[model samples]
Target chain A: MIPNNISKLIDAIINKTEAKKAIWGKTSRNEEFKLFLEKGAVTTDTWVENGIEAIDFAIYNSYGDKIDNFVAYKGDDDFDILSRLHNTAKREFFKVDETIENLFKELNDPKSVGKRQIEDDTPLPF
Target chain B: MKKTISISIIGVVGIILCIYFFEDSDKTLPNYATVIGTICSIVGLSIAYINILALKEESIIISKQIHLTLEKVNQLNSLSEISKAIKVNQEIQEFLRNEKIELARLRTLDLKYMLLHFNNDLLLNELTSDEEYKKLILDFGIDLNSLNETLINSKRKVDFTKVVKNLEELSTYLTKFELKLKSIKI
Candidate 1:
């Protein structure tokens, strides 16, 4: 089950995505990319060659670790590389979704960081 | 309309009198009076028919003119709205640009303080070596070099050029629309 804050954040993201398929153009991927964007994903344009389009994106976990991903689509025929990039970014970022969720849960917890059970010597796996 | 109807009625009466007068004229010797009357009556009839047609055409032209005027007014209104949008976009773009630059500057200052604190902490405790200090700070994800580099590379240029261009295009279109409207006869 999603936490109350998480659920509310997701709703805000979804609500802000207006006619996603229309604005971004239709793609086979689900609309999860919008959520990833809202969660602080950064995308950059890459070089295109020989009817191929490319874009790169960096997704940051709550711990500030970056996951890089790229999407390459055919430039010809109404193909939308931006939407594809979003989907790829989201998918790559999802690999560490559990860590991110745990981080958020820890942050939202009532206890301060000093009062937490974590030991000073304990290394963070982030 | 009443004047046109009255003239038409007079024209019909004139034509009837001309015909009645001409009915008695000998075919071999044409009657000058009858011919003159007939010519005058025919001219009058023609003028009355032309006048009525002109009135109808004038009404149509007036209505068409009103429509064109309304369209012109609407286009002007749209141009004003677009101008307002462009103004707002420019203000927002400027604000965002300044805000980003300020934020980046502040972040760099914060990072410098963090580094100073780290150095101060090391000085107070003389046991830790330089490499160990660097490693401990790096482990905590506070790479001063990377952070400084990022701050140097950060750009805060908010581009509202495309939006401005689009609005300008719409303005141009409205100007052209106005020109087209002016060229219309109605």
Candidate 2:
């Protein structure tokens, strides 16, 4: 049986991952996603790949060799194990999505946009 | 003093020539005297015209020098403003490192305005060409956006080592840019 603490941690990770995935699905089409990729130095494909790799690494570091046993043990359903693992990867991938979205909003604020326009329009006296 | 002396000499010479031409016993100016007076007047007028032209040329040179100096001053001013913005950004980074989220957020807003002003100053002074300016804007925007992300993530207990590294890279780039601006010769 999975220990209660480990099970709890996995649940938390899965929940966070699902939340992030939903947000990413909504935002991946926006212009800010491109900006995020540029600043974060990851293309869309690499970002997803990296996210999965990070989740795997985190799981390994946290569980060590026991992760295999946790997966193989019949105490947990095979489908449940796979679903949890998938959600964990998604959570890792979407970790910074909200942060990037907030940043884009701050930058694209109307006040800032208007200020830039005014500056561009003003003529130099010289 | 030299111009006054020359004018005085010319005036005395004119008076003497007038006297010489008019002192004929018949009290009439001779043809040769009239011709000499006309020649002298022509020569004096030509000299005056040449002097005026030289003065005009000197004024133009002075104006151009003034213009060049002003442009250099503007360049330096824009660079200093950029330096100030960089310093503020450094402070924001420090605030982030210290876990001062609210302070960093407030300062980030200030830095945004400063960056805007810096961009305008750069454009006004023509420090960077349009293409170069666009590239610079992209670079800075990326850095600032990353900084913003770091600030936001800090609230959620996210590891910020990567953001800090990116900020350091930006700081290095900005320092190099500052040096490049300083090296520009008018």
Candidate 2 per-residue C-alpha lDDT over B1-186 given as tens digits, one digit per residue, 9 for 90 to 100 = 356457657766775676676646645557556655775676577668768877999999999999999978887887787688688778877887896757766776676676556555543445333344443444344434434544554322323444455456556655665877788787
TM-score of 2: 0.44
DockQ of each: 0.02, 0.02
Q: Give the fraction of reference interface contacts each candidate recovers.
A: 0.00, 0.00
Please tell me what DockQ candidate 2 reaches.
Answer: 0.02
lDDT score of residue A15 within candidate 1: 42
Q: How well does each candidate superpose onto the true structure, as a TM-score?
A: 0.27, 0.44
lDDT of 1 by residue, B7-62 (tens): 66776676566556665544324565666567667767777787879889999999
Provide the RMSD of all predictions against the true structure, rounded to 1 decimal. 25.8, 23.3
Query: Which pairs in model 1 have colliding backbones?
Result: none
| lDDT (Cα) of model 2 | 0.50
Chain A TM value for model 2:
0.30
| Poorly placed runs, candidate 1 (over 4 Å) | A1-32, A35-89, A92-126, B1-52, B98-186
